[model samples]
Target: MAPLLLLGLLGLLGLWVLLRARTPAPGWPPGPRPLPLIGNLHLLRVSQQERSLMELSEQYGPVFTVHMGLQKTVVLTGYEAVREALVGTGQRLADRPPIAIFQLIQGGRAWGQAGSPWPTKPCRSSGAWWTSWSSTELFNIYPRLGALLQLHQPVLRKIEEVRAILRTLLEARRPPAPGPGPVHSYVDALLQQGQGGDPDGLFGEDNVVACVLDMVMAGTETTSATLQWAALLMGRHPHVQGRVQEELDRVLGPGRPPRPEDQRSLPYTNAVLHEVQRFITLLPHVPRCTAADTRLGGYLLPKGTPVVPLLSSVLLDKTQWETPHQFNPGHFLDAQGHFVKREAFLPFSAGRRVCVGESLARTELFLLFAGLLYRFRLLPPPGLSPGGLDTRPAPAFTMRPPAQVLCAVPRPRTLACSLKTDGPSPGP
Candidate 1:
């Protein structure tokens, strides 16, 4: 009994020593006191990390340290702090912090080299992963534990599946011989670049495949999530829905599909869509790392400090927004009812590492959103009241809308047809 008690005391002392060594360097910003091994994970509350971080910001100020598992991260909150760190810091805070799964998939490279095609491949696979909150978070914090528990098998399998699918697509689209040609498709452009035009020397077979996977995955998920939120918000706020439909009716009028140019004419509808992105704040934080020693928000961050420019805090910033928590389309509209673009409206984030798909995403959101609202009066399921419909996000890699039935009650102008989740069709 005496020997066991002595060993236990020694273990406690060792833990104290380990935690002392884990303390943030002197210049790092203030933060909540962290516990052993887990760090400040308890304060973050896992699923609602964005809100938790925002709450912590109130305690620690704009720039503060938060330990996510063993990883020491500096979280930049509010519009001013996030904007300054992201936009003002130049390339000093532009690098992405390495994730275990990405490192594993990239064969230990810190994600793919930059170009037009490398923001979100595995993120796409992350959807197919369908990993629950506990397991995925655990995997992120302790990859070795996940491997010990067999959590990585699904991810490894998905990697195989993505590669296999890409191989099939590439084989189907491979030219009879490599030669000068008009770019017919995404595959052709990549093949052409690999053959000669790759200026950065990045488009080899492995990198090209990586690029294509990213393009395909990046192509779908984020835009789809935004659209899902737009539809949900429309159901929840029918007054806003009516206003959008009214704009779509006056401007679009059923004869034509929503084109990119139609956005300028449809101000209310555009504002509503922008509000959807702001309110939900999906994909709230993507961690970035300091390439060199950087000073931000009056704190001197050493090299490689993982920084989170909290996009949610920016979107919900009380200083920049009139009704920060509410779904107000007027936030993007002026007194005369013309659509106004606010500098604080940074749904695609800002700066050097801003989302690569920003332009494409904007066009897609406008066209798809306008077209959907034009045809359908989105409604809550038969039993659920619009007021009672769940606005709470389901836990996933994103702040995903809760799965609930919605009725696409068609408007009088559009012909009734079978609705599908795929791309739009021309006729009834």
Candidate 2:
């Protein structure tokens, strides 16, 4: 009994030492005290994670530490802090943090807590907890536990299935011979790279498929979500919508599709598009890691520290805009009514890890929005006024507009029959 008691005491001592070792890193920025094992996870209760972080920033300043699992994350808020960390010293903070869902998809090594079983009660409770929360918070929180469940393997298999599908498409698109083929598609360029016998194997079959998948996934989802928000916002702001449509009608008319060059002529429309991105702030925070110990906002962020640069804070920073809280297209427009880019306009994030698909996304937004608005007059649902429409976005990987109906009345002057809506069209 004496020996057993001694061993038990030794085990408890070891546990205490382990927990102490995992405390917030030395000289890390200030934050609410983190509990052992769970860290500050329990304290992160806000529906919109960005808002919660913003509130914490109000107390902790622009930079602060929040423990996510055993990991220490430094959250950077506002344009000044975000710019200093992401742009001023980009290379030092360019590494992508190892997220569990991404790791499962990337087929990287499972994280330390990858297989830790979640209690059935907490699983259900956590789901219920976030049902009213924004997708951003839910998305970030769910993935933290997603890999722990039995469902993870199936998710991995699904990712493999997707890769297989991509491979099949690559096989179909491959030229009969590698040399002198037109770089007809993104896949073709990747295939051509593989043939070039690059020493880095940058264009290997898996790499090519992964690249295509990344482009397709990143390019499609966020762009589609942004366009959805644009349509919804337009419906909520008929006057703004009318102005955009007027510009589109004047520049391209209904006879022709909107070309990329047409954006130069459609200044108001361009401003609206930029405002949509800024207003929606699709991605509230982008996850990053420090490649080396770095100083940001007078805080010492250690090497390998996970960093969340809050893009939403910058977009909504009062100092950066005339009406940061309001959905004002004038934010992107000069007194001359020309489209002007703001230094604080960072919806795509900035620095070394700036979104690779920024140009593609911009092109997609301008063309799709101009075409849609030019051919349709967006209106709120029957009995719903634009003022009644909820601007609070649903939290997700991107900021999703709330579930509500919009009326897309076809423009009588539209020459394109495809866009000429017979009646109100349902929106996502």
Candidate 3:
């Protein structure tokens, strides 16, 4: 009986090893070999995540796989691969990976032990009372109070005012600041959402604050970085820069501020913006997760597999763009000089989880960009050559130009025109 039992145990062990060997491992479509355990994590962390991924795609073919921890992340590179993965089977790719950091910080009460104690004493005297107001109820009271204060409101002022009130209410809910006064600005927006009956109700105040912090960290860094790159690119190519300025001059005139509507008539300006988005490719990779067991490129992707969509690969794919490496506005323009939107141009990403603040980001970019361009002509500082404009991008959490500053000489019209008027009047 003992001998029989030993034989059976050995047989079971052999079967397990056989199954492990037979199960195909996930990997890049076809490229450089991976090291054990660590897999491609080292490659990604070292190789300048976006650009290195693009180069790897050039060798390995689009739709490769990399592993982050025990999880396999299938990377979709190039326009076709990204489009098929995102737009074609978009629903499948909509869910984001449960990033450990996000889960820890944003997961709320579910994160820790069920019986975690709460303070018996109030964190603050009025904190409990302030926490009860819904965002809607707060907004209702704010306008009447503002009217009583005799504040003159402008268009969109209501939204701004509501945001301000929400911020204050949120701040009041928190414990008193440590040393100095509390920080203000958008952080308040998060606090408001938390205290205000979950304006979206998806999260509590802590989660709201975490989400807002994520947005601030993600949104501000990426947009500012892209703008810096755009400036560098424009400085590098004077003719392109001149064309943009000429378009601004024609559509907006020398004296007036550019409005959102003017974007329609300013094709060149629009094209430049598009090309800037393409060139910099702010977020080269967007991380997603498989909702269920699936097959991609003949490889079995188990449910909950992490996926990294290489956005820069699509932007820089040689097959998609005529001058993939060059700064070219023509990528977004037609023979008639009209702005041509392309499926490949996905700087803001695509699908359900696409950047939530895309519209706001675009508006801010257009306003800030047009505002600056209208007011001044950016030039290489005196004694500095135009060629000296640093095109080298410093990869951080986002891609941005190297530390360098250019002179923004006020345009003649900017100097002459009053802030109230569009520009200086034409002489008789």
2 versus 3: better TM-score goes to: 2
Q: What lDDT tens digits, residue by residue, belong to model 1 across residues 241-345?
A: 998888788887757779999889999988999999999887788788999899988999899989999999999999999999999999999999999999999
What are the per-model C-alpha RMSD values against the true structure?
6.0, 5.9, 16.6
Candidate 3 regions with alpha-carbon error over 4 angstroms: 1-32, 41-47, 107-204, 413-428
1-428 per-residue lDDT for model 2 (tens digits) = 99999999999976995678466466888988876555676667543678888889999999998876456788999989999888899589888776655665555633221121111111224553433433223334556454454435544555676788898999998878757678877778889878756788767786677677676566666887788888888877889987887777777765888999988898899888899898888878878888998988887777888899999999999889989888899988888898897999999888998877788889988888988877787776668788887777654445666666667777874232221111111211
lDDT of 2: 0.73
Question: What's the ranking of the predictions by lDDT, best on top?
Answer: 1, 2, 3
Query: In candidate 1, how many Å is residue 111 off?
Result: 5.3
Ranking by TM-score: 1, 2, 3
Error of 3 at 196 (Å): 7.7
| TM-score of candidate 1 against the unseen true structure | 0.87
Point to the candidate with the largest TM-score: 1
List TM-scores for all candidates, in order. Answer: 0.87, 0.83, 0.69
Name the lDDT value of residue 274 in candidate 2. 91
Which scores greater on lDDT, model 1 or model 2? 1
